[model samples]
Target: MSRIGKMPIAIPAGVEVKVVGPKVSVKGPLGKMDWPLEEGLGAVVENGQLLVNRLSEDRNVRALHGLARAELSNIVLGVSKGYERSLEITGVGYKVALQGRTMSFNVGYINPVLFQIPAGIEVKVDKQTLINVKGFDKRLVGQVAANLRAIKPPDVYKQKGVRFMGEVLRKKEGKTGK
Candidate 1:
């Protein structure tokens, strides 16, 4: 039995989980998410906990068992309490501002980058340097943040650009005259 798959996902209050055929739907205060399970994977609720089971011994089936369970758990939790990722800008004059759902980034560029925020995700700026990303879907939230950060990822030499809060930037030393 898969260790992670064997574990039951505790259903928190106000979160609803429904299993129908090969699909599982999770709904909570924040939003709703659904995913289709593999051919041999099944889900059931018992003792107020969600259980994931695999119907085959195939390597591929076993591999997806745990992964699917974990993703479902995260979805439940995310919908209940939501998810967030914080980012910070580090530079002398680099900063960001949100104007009516458009992100204006001034990262040492000739013109500011105007990014249109996608639906279901909220971006907030503070003090001209801090960025807060909030959403229900963990994957989408993180991917969007990564894309934004990639616009001008923190540099090793001077550590300028947008970066996750507390993320470490390895500094590089300049070559010396020999």
Candidate 2:
């Protein structure tokens, strides 16, 4: 038995969990999220806690048992408390601004890059260089942050560009003249 899968998830106050066949939906104060149950895995609500079970101990079932548990845990946490990712701009003249649902970036590019914020996610700029991405879905928040960082990834030589908050970059030495 998987250690993680064996543990039960305690549902918090004001949170509602619904299991319909192979689908589970979690709704809380923050928002609602749904996940499809993987094959050979089952979820049940008992005594105000969520439990995950597997049909058998097959190789594939064992692999999915832990994954399903983790995913379900994420869903419960997301709807209740939400998730967030922070990024920082590390170059001169680089800044970020939000106009409605679109975010414009001025990261040394000839033309400013405009990225539209998807529904259910919020982007906030602070001190013109710090970016905060918040959403109920952890995966979406992380993917959006990655997409923004990809716009101008940090350079090894200058260590300049967009980077996750607290992320450390190794600077490369430039060639010396003879």
- Output the number of the TM-score-best candidate: 2
Candidate 1 deviant stretches above 4 angstroms: none
Structure candidate 1, residue pairs in collision: none
Report how far off residue 57 is in candidate 2 (Å): 2.7
Give the lDDT of residue 151 in candidate 2: 96
Clashes within 3 Å, all models in order: 0, 0
Pairs clashing in candidate 2? Answer: none
Q: Lowest lDDT 10-mer window, candidate 2?
A: 32-41
**Every candidate's lDDT:** 0.91, 0.93
Global Cα lDDT for candidate 2 = 0.93
C-alpha-based local distance difference test score of model 1: 0.91
Identify the candidate with maximal lDDT. Answer: 2
